[model samples]
Target chain A: METQIDKLEQNKKSKEKKTQPEKEELKGTFAAVLIVGGIILVGWLGVFGLFLERA
Target chain B: MHLHRYEKIWLMLGAGGLALFIVLLCVNAFAMGMAPPSNMEMIDPEKVMETPPFDKPGLKQVGDKEYDAYMTAFAFGFSPTKMEVPAGSTINFHVTSPDVVHGFQIPETNINFMVLPGHISSATHTFDKPGEYLILCNEYCGAGHQVMATTIIVK
Candidate 1:
């Protein structure tokens, strides 16, 4: 009875490990997209500001 | 917490404005690299043309004689390959282009100017001390632009 219980517990832990890598990758991608998008938006604004001041 | 409709719109706009600022800073920095240093006080090309006074203000006198260095901006290379100047001495540089327009820059010393065809460009630099400096062509003339660079040696 004890042996069967130990086997069931080990199987559950292994299943949890599989999802960890996928979760980490998704988090990394989200952070990168946010930073790049922020940079592009700022560049456009500066050019516009220069033109406005000149006008 | 639940937010009202007006608050949500303001929050989105704030985030977007912050992002726009960062992008502009990067683009401006990139553009600055293409040309010479914009600050006039640092690298003033106009100071190069006139003759030195008896008071010897900004000019450096080496061995009681002025060295005339010829830097040609031609199809492929700069003629002398290396320039040497004494420490605490003001050296005059005569830059000319036998071909198209090219940019001359010494990034370490913040020396940048343009050499146009059918005209002579001149600049003077006072070496406060001694070290090696680099000179580069900032403009994208054509092929071989990448290798269009030389060095200035100060003793």
Candidate 2:
């Protein structure tokens, strides 16, 4: 019974280890998307401002 | 795939931003009447001289405080190079090219468009301020492209 409990604990630890890199990858992707979104918003606002001035 | 809580939130926000951009563009174009040049009017490049309105290229009073300016662009020169219109008058510019492609751009106003050989491009603007607006051919047509300019005297 002790050996079975030890196996279960090891399985849970391995599962967490596999998910560690996945979480990091997701974080990187989210940061990249936010940066791109911010750039697009700023560029669009600049263009709209120019349009208003010219029009 | 199972998305994390933060990832799902970010995705929704990104989609919402994109939607907002599209809506703004639509409102500006349709509601505000801002648009690019359209190819609605066509003419024969070789017979541009024989055309009715272009044959007599000049400004004509169409209504009270409104005028129509018919213009033709050819090989580094515009016909009726000097134009005069009353201040606070709305002028509808009808422009076409005979020889090659050129650009009709009046500085300090929203009067800029491509003058194609067989297409009649047009734009309308009201000159509220009485000033001389320089009309320049923004497109490079030939050697004399530098001097391809005129003046619109708004008085």
Best by lDDT: 2
Estimate, for each residue in B1-155, the C-alpha lDDT of model 2 and write its tens digit: 76777688798998898898799889989998876764589999999999989998999999998999899988878888898888899988899998999999987777889999999998988888999988889999999999998888999
B1-155 per-residue lDDT for model 1 (tens digits) = 65544445556766777787668667766964432322232212233223223112222344543655556665566656767766666656656665677888766453567876645566655666588877788887789888888877778
TM-score of predicted model 1? 0.43
Query: Model 1, which residues run further than 4 Å from truth?
Result: A1-55, B1-66
Q: Chain B TM-score of model 2, please? A: 0.89
Residue A22 of model 1, lDDT score: 33
Q: Model 1's CAPRI class?
A: incorrect
Q: Which ten residues in a row have the lowest lDDT in candidate 2 chain B?
A: B32-41
Error of 2 at B113 (Å): 1.3
Itemize residue pairs with steric clashes in candidate 2: none
Query: All candidates' TM-scores?
Result: 0.43, 0.80
Global lDDT of model 2: 0.87
Q: Which regions of candidate 2 fall more than 4 Å away from where they truly are?
A: A1-22, A25-36
Clashes of 1: 8
